[model samples]
Target: MSMKDDLNKLNETVKQYRDELRVQMHLAQQDVRDEWDDLDEYWDKFRQKLDDIRHDADGVGQDTRETAYNLGEELKAGYERIRKRLK
Candidate 1:
């Protein structure tokens, strides 16, 4: 597939993961939120990494988008676990 098609697929996959993350965040306990705040700086750094990686394919390199998307999935999984604990 072309780079544009690959990018489109990546975008859609990331969107789904992002949506799940939002759901998990919504269901997460206040205590969990507080705990997350303890690592707020870490998350901020991660966000910066992601931001830097997101750009035209040439500017960022081939794996940049994929790596960011994988990080997003990992974050979502963490949020999902916290949400489950809140249940």
Candidate 2:
């Protein structure tokens, strides 16, 4: 297979695993997953910020890099905090 095809398959595999994880999380009633899901707004914002960074890399300089990095760190921190509260 070509490199592109291989990469596409890998991407699809990763997506499938993520979907399976969501199903398992729901079945297990994992509070962390639920909280993560509820934080959709923040997640969406983060995603948009990343996309903007990619599109406008000219302005995504040092400060924007730091901001994006910190946002990701904060999100991960929040996820960890909620995870600790999980039953």
Candidate 3:
């Protein structure tokens, strides 16, 4: 085949892969959105915990602080997972 014909064939293959990947990427995004929605409660609780701690830092017990810290860490990890999925 001529150089032009070979280039055309390669271009077609790339286009096919690009189209397939586009669909897969869209599905991946939906999965990520679902994961985020699942984390919504955790996010809300984490925010509320922080607000409580800020409002009553002096009155907050050690266990309460620890619980808030653990929840924050969990949220961070969950967000990191979503980030990696997007990548």
After the best TM-score superposition of candidate 2, give how far the Cα of residue 50 lies from its true spot, in angstroms: 0.7
Cα lDDT over the full model 1: 0.56
| Clash numbers, per candidate | 0, 0, 0
* lDDT tens per residue, model 1, 54-85: 44445876566665556555555655555467
Q: Provide TM-scores for the models.
A: 0.47, 0.50, 0.64
Instruction: Estimate, for each residue in 38-87, the C-alpha lDDT of model 3 and write its tens digit.
Output: 66677677667666766887887777666666666666666667656666
lDDT of 2 by residue, 8-82 (tens): 443344344344445545544556666667654555665566667668867666665556555555555555555
RMSD of each: 4.8, 7.7, 19.9
| Residue 40, candidate 1: alpha-carbon lDDT | 48
- Give the distance in Å from residue 71's predicted Cα in candidate 1 to where it truly belongs: 0.8
Off by over 4 Å in 2: 1-38
Quantify all predictions' global Cα lDDT against the true fold: 0.56, 0.54, 0.60
Q: Order the candidates by lDDT, highest first — what do you get?
A: 3, 1, 2
Superposition-based RMSD of candidate 3 using all C-alpha atoms, in angstroms = 19.9
- Give the top-scoring candidate (lDDT): 3
